[model samples]
Target: MSTPSADESVELEWDDIQSGALHERPSPYVGRYVLIRIDDREAGRELVRRLLPAIEAGHPTADPARDAWITVAFTYQGLRALGVPSDSLDSFAPEFRAGMAARAAELGDVGDSDPGNWEQPLGTPAVHIALAALSPDSVRLAKVMERAQQAYGQLPGVEVIWRQDCYQLETGRTSFGFRDGIGQPAVEGTGRNTNPHEAPIKAGEFLLGYPDETGALPPMPSPDVLGRNGTYLVFRKLHTRVAAYRQYLYDQASSRAEERLLAAKTVGRWPSGAPLSLSSDQDDPELGADPDRNNRFSYHDDLDGFKCPAGAHARRANPRGALDHENSVNVRLHRMIRRSTSYGPSLPEGVREDDGADRGIVFVCVGAHLKRQFEFVKTQWLNDGIFIGAPQEADPLVGRSDTPGVFTIPRRPVRRRLRNLPPFVVTRGGEYFFVPGLRALRWLSELDS
Candidate 1:
């Protein structure tokens, strides 16, 4: 595909969209997430371009750039969808593949590498295909997804299923029972695609720009090197030790969940976006209404950790207090649009003692810089204990390690040696991928065709 032309004049505005502010707008109601799995890298990308027309055609608005938001999660398997089970899935694979191949032949490939008719990017690779994210406003987006199944439902070697999403956060980090999106930089825009405020808009600002106060960005392609609108996505299926976590909580206090849950509320955003801080003592329905009130609160309260906590997920994700003179830097540089969902099964009633129902979260992050936001949370706050003041290693909930997993609690010990601390979360699988803008998508499809 031809190199994408840069648009240097798209200025982004930084607006305060905390949980309280979001509630005034309207709950971001959404239904059925559509995912498509493809093989290998090249074929997966080609298929994505080929399917763009059909996918975009399904939307009510004809303009894909403004109306559609597409993010690709690259793992061992390029694209895979969860929670979309239709009976016609068996027949849709081959037809879609043929369409992708035909489109590639129509437009010659363009880039540093020469190409002709190429094999599907997968020889023995597995991938996931995520469609344009459908917000509450884009009601027709779901219908388009439904129609996609009609065209290729019976294709073999592909599985489509339905998923129950638990939470969605700013900076694109889902509620994984661990702190995410902490210390993320804010760009000047809306949705989960653009950068937050407090950061520069240089061509490589988010991607491969010069290193600032922090260490160098991860070894990934910068927007300058690749294109302005491209960003990387990381996906992982984390298994939360619900039973063990609960046991540790109960052992510590009379009502552990109730106490911690309240702390979450004070922060104005629940592990999910329920916003107990703004709504009722329980999960408030209206907190999702006003964005002004929902996301407007600081843990600096002396409320005995009732409204907020010393190390709650929301607090840990964005420790605004740590910034210049009371987290002024955090307010500017640590804002990210987190978009994540829960995976695995719900905890069964009365079935305590670690059943391993395989519950955790699907962590998906989008920002001008992937390493700055997602990677930072993973390596620093989540994995490194230094951010929390404790002399420990890794996040008690979702930190990474070479020796399986670990967890930590205030009082008492459950798994591991409570003293050395153990990981409360475990990682099953994860991979890094890129999400491209609509213009690039069209260019790719037309070029290879």
Candidate 2:
């Protein structure tokens, strides 16, 4: 096996992340979940052995100690084959929620459940677990994922094999409201990432050995390519600064909820897919529903930064045309199929202004390489302020500054443009993981046994 040199790797570049053939169409398979790192992987294995029967009986993982975060499971192929009923998804959702609520109670009070202020003038972006807390339970959770994958692999007739589905700490806005997963790359071969007809997975810098020449490879690669097609899962728990966000909006709002909503519109999308680019004053439900229309439009058409400001959360997360005309299409390929859910709760009504509460989203990204996809976006774009010296520093929505050089999202107001857009999110904890394929899972189970 030949390895590319450091310089060689750097030189390799894809026109867009999705510049090749797609292994599969982007589906709901990308469910977000959070794996609690337990103290011992063996201990977790032991618990899994005991819990298998119980989980089969429709109970949560029997391992009590391993339950720490509410995991979002993506796709049903594996579980369904294990005799898990296809119709049970909606029914099982509550069970999943119950499991999460129970786990949250064990961890700590994330926050209150008031969804009122979200519509108010200004509020700090709501805090929810974008990542899971560091604990011994994480080990157990990792083993659980391994076991689950292995168990599913044994079942019959699974078409598209999944290497791993991202687990995240359950987090999101109040009930009944949709949270849009924006900045998606079009199907690689489908013209979303690159020129139409190219495969989604490009080679160079995608996985370990594959170069960009081949284009988009299968999401779950053949075992021979990487020895184990287990892609890396980047786990990050981002704490949204709720109070600060609320204060900002409340301070700026005039009369109606629409004014406050407009502030949010500047960021694009109302937690839902509503496009502020087209409907800046109010969220257009119709536009939000259409993925073709919503994900396709950008602020580049109106360079004044009114439709979607350069600093807006959506625009910043995905600069699209702001970076360069074709840049959005190309870079969108790198976008991870996110399956994040909100965790924690809204701030209580009368907890005093200074009272501290913890809340955020458990952000998880499943990709071939943590460095190329997650780390590159985080360090170079999201966390790095003054990227290419264009706009402000760092993404105000979810960027964080930890110990200066390690990672810094410097808070700088938009110069000669919009005023006083503070940093609204912070990173509390994070880790990188390798989610293995089902075959790999069986291999690990054998090792564990």
Candidate 3:
């Protein structure tokens, strides 16, 4: 396979694609995710028809209308529930058809994170549709949410099962106290190249109907209108133990400075979002605030893991320039568009006792290939660490460490290893959905009824 070429130019049909594909979410925004089930085929189809007019094409971040809009996707069972033909449904990727719940073992969602323990309607086949609405302010969000509710409010056989309202806190940190939504990839066609070190990835890596990093078009699901401009989405609700995380860090460190450093090494970034690769010794709030410089550093130079440990969460998630030495490792192929938000309330600072309030993050990822992009990262990088030369260790933050695991941090004269690492993030519930294009929405609504 060839690397993404900067010389390549392809104009995409922005009007047909979902707006989230090109959406650059604003900081301090509020959003809601709703899960629905379909009992009657006509009702499901009618729900799509009503939502079609509301979900328009991609819009710029500056566009006021961009703040308030809804986007929808369907599960494998959802397609069948909508009366889609067998051949078309079968054409979808096998992992997607099997559902995230079925592939839990492969994703290392074992022990307490198992699917059996997942939230109701999330892992079940009843979850047919997923709707997401976003806005910078609550008023705008309410306007669109009202429209979204009216879209399926009275539709018989179409029931809204579960919903999660999430947002970025005033501190701009997740429940875990790290800045979220950094290191976003720039698509080749979009004029949003933020990272100066790397060229824009191929457009097909995230959207269908274009050449991906492998120099070929990604596999699309059946009829052109249904899959051409569409892509797959992975939505997850993770339950974080904020008190446990805070106490663990406190116990591991002797002073406040050491505590901050330990947190940075664990996540590969400071609470301000400055990458350890650039600011290794101390936290740099100014660098983290600068969009152009914060995400520009790479791990290739820190091969010995002195600056940023190989097993750190950010490095393991995206090795970037570090994997060039590996023969079969193509970091670009495993990339996914990540846009996650925090749910529940942010645990107050310095509070080490369990509050019992359910709080964490709602992760949203978009890609054309489910198995390669989303699943590959979860299985290979997060769940296991063989690629980074540590087989026993998993992601220190989210990995489901059934038995106590170890996290290695390389130092000057001697390396430091944190042992008996317990799982910090638990899987509350999650699902996979096919986020279709505007034309595909029309195609789905107009299906034989």
Give the candidate order by descending TM-score: 3, 1, 2
Q: Give the TM-score of candidate 1.
A: 0.56
10 residues in a row with least lDDT, candidate 2 = 120-129
lDDT for model 1, on a 0 to 1 scale? Answer: 0.39
**What Cα-based lDDT does every candidate model obtain?**
0.39, 0.39, 0.86
Specify the highest-TM-score model's number: 3
lDDT digits (tens) for residues 352-421 of candidate 1: 4776465666555554454456555555565555655543544444444333333333322332223333
Indicate the TM-score of model 2: 0.54
User: TM-scores for all candidates?
Assistant: 0.56, 0.54, 0.97
Count of steric clashes across candidates, in order: 94, 68, 0
Q: Candidate 2's residue-wise lDDT over 420-440, tens digit each?
A: 555555544433443333333
Off by over 4 Å in 3: 1-8, 62-66
TM-score, candidate number 3: 0.97
Candidate 3's displacement at residue 164, Å, is 0.6
